[model samples]
Target: MFAFCADPKTLEGAAWFACYLTSATHLAMYWSVLTVMLLLALAAPSALMFGFGGALMARSHIPPLAWVGKGYISMVRGVPDIVFFLFVPIAVDQGLEYLMHVTRCADWTEPVRRGADFVVCPQAKIPQSTAPAYVHDAYAFALALLAFALVFGAFAANTLKGAMEAVPRAQVETAEAYGMNRAQAFRRIILPQMWVYALPGLTNLWMILVKATPLLFLLGIQDIVYWARELGGSKTQVYAYPHPDWRVWYFLALLVFYLGLTWASERVFARVQNRLSVGQATAAGEALRKAGAA
Candidate 1:
């Protein structure tokens, strides 16, 4: 910020605007974008891992495991995502707190659910009552991340399970004929081949996750959406830089940001799919071979 920015009250026009934009609150707003990115970066891989586990469970020989996996996939599909987004964090938080309460306060006589209140001892509170403000925020964010992962993972599981099954039965039969066990055949043939099939659905899910980042506001995280609303509200003469409601512009910026993210991700995923198909027995690979021969 320039020296003139030191006296914001006396500043006007572009100088005042620049100063305002570079203020502490605005800096925090800028950093929140990175927070969103960090969440996506961390959550995507975690969700994929969860999805892989779920898919394996669905394919398990154990009937109960298969049932549980199938139920998880189906339940998520049937419910509206926003409902899960709202419910998952609260449920996970309370569940954690409840477990802690039972462990830490074994002698407490009070029932946890006394008319809709989830009462837990102060010692069992996540981040603890004595913890700093940011600790509470971080704990909340972690819960939100878990919620996002669980919901998205269920969808990913369904996609992966279908993809895994879509890998040619003939391939598995050949592997078995060669004395390969089911596990060996799955590891050597199915896992690698299934990815080409799964990539499309997974890419779509990634886009959906990107779009859903705005829901961080709903989770009480101070994300871009929250900052947009806060900064874009009308400011009166009582403030350093009085302005009318500019929410439309703020939202428009968010739209552009998301559009850019999706567009870039599409380009990246397309290249990855092409690379993954290079030596495969798929139609895309066959086409590439034909082109190379020509």
Candidate 2:
């Protein structure tokens, strides 16, 4: 911020606009791109872990565990992701508050739910009602992240399950014949080979995750889309940075941001696909084989 930015009123033209763009709020808005990226970074691996668990459970010899795994994978197919995105955080939050209420407010005889209201003792509040703004924001973010992980985890579970099955049956049999137990075969042989098959589905999931970042707004996080709508709205002369409606321009920038992300992800996944394909028995591997020989 320049000295001129101290008085946005005196400024004019691009300089005025530049100062406005660099304003504290706008800077925060700009940094929200990183928030989206951070969400993806955290959510992707977390979801993958959840997916791996689900896939493993799905393939379990035990009937109950197998049913749970299959149910986990099948849940997404019947339900819309947006519905999960909306419902999961509230469910988790209320579930936590309910548990806390039971543990911390046992003396209170009042009902936890009265009509449509969900009321809990102050001690049962997540981050507490008196907590700092940042604490509240962080709590909301954590819930959103969990929701993302659970929903995407289901998709990932399905993909990983198929990938596991796609690993040649003969290879698994050979591992078993070589004195390897089921777990050892999965770890040393099946798991390694499944990645090549899983990579395509995972890549698609990554792209879907990127697009879905905008839904963070629906979850009440002040993500990039939230800032775009906020900053693009008209500000009066009394405000530090007065501006006309610029939602179109702001959204165009978001479009560019997402396009760039998609392009970068494609390039990265291409490299990863190639790397995973090395020495595999697939079309990509065959191509790499001929090229290496040539």
Candidate 3:
């Protein structure tokens, strides 16, 4: 903020816009972009880990474990994403509070589900309803991240399962025949080969994940979309910086932001795809080899 910003009504043209942009609220809006990025950065890996576990379970020798894993993948992916987006965070939060209530407030005799209000001992409340602002924000973001991970993880599991199955059965058997155990064969042959097949599906998943960042608003996090609406709404002249409805411009900025994100993501995935295509038997690999030879 500048001295001019102290009385924003006196500012005009670029100066007015400059001060407006640098206001504390605008800075928070800008930082919200980083929140989206952090979610993606964290969620992608978490989803992959969950997917890997699910895929392993789906293919497990134990019938019950395989059923549970397959069921998870089927159930999550089969359900509509919006439902999960709305449902998961609330369910997880309440579930956690309930568990804590049992442990921390065992002596409390009141029913938790009191006429549709999910009440718990105040001591068992997550963040205790009295923690710092940042703690509440962190708790909300963590729940949103978990929702993303669970939904995306199921989809990733399906993709990975197909990729794993796509590896040739003969090759696996031959590798085992040549003194490699099942684990060694899987690590050396199947694992390396599956990526080329998996990359395409995984790349699409990444894009979908990127697009879904806007859903943070539904999860109680004050994300960029929330800021855009708050800051871009028309303010009357009674306010220091009066402005007409500028939501169009704010949303246009969002459009450009997302387009740029997807553009950068495509370039990254393309490079990764090309990198994975080197020196293998697939058509893309063969083409890459020829290109290298030339």
Candidate 4:
């Protein structure tokens, strides 16, 4: 970036360091931080959608729907998250391929399971073997996003369901007494009040989600952790700006990045909670009311 950076091989000290950090590979490395942030930003809302559906299903009047929702939430809770992180994408991928195979290869009678192998028609391959590199990367990212959403959604569903139930029975009863039906009471009374109760758990889930971004490396996504490992290793003299083993420093920078992310998220969530609590009967709202009067 600077005049001295014109000859990276001959430069030393701060000059070489500056040029090294500005290299194309390092630029991609920097961009990977944004990728992590984007993943979180996208995943949070998607997970909330999944959680809302799951929570609603759990509360469904239909016995089978309730069982499915309850089972989804409970099964995920007992399993190690890492296991699901690994399993979900592969399972989803294969399931998609299997459905495609059945439809696209209707005349074929080959069993999908041949011992350890999963055989499917070439047309059934996700992204297809002929697709470009970027398409493959996008496919992988989509799967990763789904895995994140599904895992976190289960936790969110449990929290939301509990929060829904925690809304006072008296409040719902009064709404009904005032001629509101179950659906009306839920929409006007229960849904509005549940946020305050759910905020604490949802905030904790956000922190967990932030920490879990590193696991993207395991899923073959070139996230910040992957870039750190790549750029922080020792470089040879053949490279323009050779360096020593700097993995420790790279990982340290990542640590700071995550710490800052969590700290900022905490501040934002706290502000949101305060805003949502205003005029509510919660302890925080009550306290705020008293303090404002004083």
Candidate 5:
């Protein structure tokens, strides 16, 4: 920000525009881009971990565990994702508070759910009623992250399960012939090989996750979509910065942002896919071999 930014009202043309853009609200809007990035950064790994666990469970010998894993994947696939996004935060929040309420409000016997209202004692409030605004925002963001992880993890689980099955049955038998147990064979042969099969599905999931970031607005997070609407809406002369509706321009920027992210992701995945195919039996591997010989 320059000295000229001191009096936005006095400035005109480019100067006025610069001062307005650098204003507090606009800075917050700019920061919303980082919020979207943070969600992706945090959510991706968390979702992957969840997916890995689900996939492993689904592959387990134990019937109960396998059932749970299969059920999770099936349920998530069967349901709409927006339903999960809306339901999870409220459900998790209430579940946490209910546990706290049982412990903290044992003596207070008013019904927590009386017909339409769900009430918890003040002490059981997440971040407490008196906490700072940032704490509230952080908590909401965390809930949104968890919801994203759970939903995407199911899809990831399905992808991983399929990949695991796609590994050659001969490879497992070969490992056994070499005196390797199930666990050893899985770690040494299956795990390494399955990733190639999984990469395409995972790449697609990443793109879907990138597009899904806009749903953060539903979770009360001040994401880029929310900022675009807020900042691009028309403001009158009564406001310090008055502007006409430029929502089309704002959304165009978001469209470009998502496109850029997807393009980069595709390039990265293509490189990874080629690298993984280097010594495999697939067509890609044969091409790579031919290319090397040439």
Candidate 6:
């Protein structure tokens, strides 16, 4: 950024390093960090919503709805996540395209599936074939987000189902005795208490999600790992900055980044669990009350 950075080839040592770090590619790499953060920020809430819905579905009185919820959780838990990571995007993408094809390509007489290829009308293409780079990136990030949400949401559903079931039978009876209807009892007694039971499992899911960000590379997103590998790869004398393979150092930075994220997540979850445990009958609540008295 300095005036001397005008001619990077003439610079060496710290000056060369500073100019290199501030280059366009490096700036893109830095922005990719935010992309990871954006994914987490969006994915966490989306996954939670899906999980909540799934839990309620499984607990529903309707047999069909309960089957779907339990099936989703079972499918996720039974299968390896990488299978979903690889399959979900393709499935979702084609599903959208196929739906559009049926509507938009209704006049066309061509079959969508021939042999190994699945073809769709150009109009049915997501973002079309000629959209800007950012739109494509956004689309890919969205797919990755969906896959993460699906996998994590299934696990969350299981956690929440257990938590919901864990609410004491006596608690519900007591609420009913106090003239509370089923819905009122659920709102006042079940919903408020389930979090204390669910937090531990949910916290673990968050950490796994944090670590799982690296799998974005598999989903065609230019996440931090991709950038680190690209930037830290050795460049020859033909390039502006020639250096040895520094991927190890780049990966080390990623290590530090993930560690920091995990540590912060743990602290946040601990505080949440503590706050939720404040007045409950759980062991943790008792400990908190005793600590308060002391």
Q: Tell how far residue 32 is off in model 6, in angstroms.
A: 1.0
Clashing pairs in 3: none
User: Which residue window of length 10 is worst by lDDT in model 4?
Assistant: 1-10
Give stretches of model 6 more than 4 Å off: 1-3
Q: Lowest lDDT 10-mer window, candidate 2? A: 1-10
Q: Which stretches of candidate 1 lie over 4 Å from their true place?
A: none
Candidate 4 or 1, higher TM-score: 1
Overall lDDT per candidate, in order of appearance? 0.91, 0.93, 0.92, 0.92, 0.92, 0.93
Q: Write the per-residue lDDT of candidate 4 for residues 1-294, one digit (tens) a residue.
A: 677777787888877778888888889888788878889999999999889889999999999999999999999988999999999999999999999998898887889899999989998888799999989988999999999999999999999999999899999999999999999999999999999999999999999999999999989888888888888899898888777999999999988998898999999999999998999889999988999999
TM-score of 3: 0.97
Better of 2 and 5 by TM-score: 5
Error of 2 at 217 (Å): 1.0
Worst lDDT run of 10 residues, candidate 3, spans 1-10
Model 6: lDDT to the true structure = 0.93
Which residue pairs show collisions in model 1?
A: none
lDDT of 2 by residue, 36-109 (tens): 99999999999999999999999999999999999988987579999999999999999999999999999999
How many clashes show up per model? 0, 0, 0, 0, 0, 0
Q: lDDT tens digits, residues 132-238, model 6?
A: 99999989988999999999999999999999989898999999999999889989999999999999999999988988998999999888999999989999989
lDDT of 1 by residue, 22-62 (tens): 98888999999999999999889988988999999999999
Instruction: Tell me the deviation in Å of residue 70 in model 5.
Output: 0.5
Model 2 stretches with alpha carbons more than 4 Å out: 236-238
Residue 64 miss distance in model 2 (angstroms): 0.3
Off by over 4 Å in 5: none
**How large an RMSD does model 4 have?**
1.9
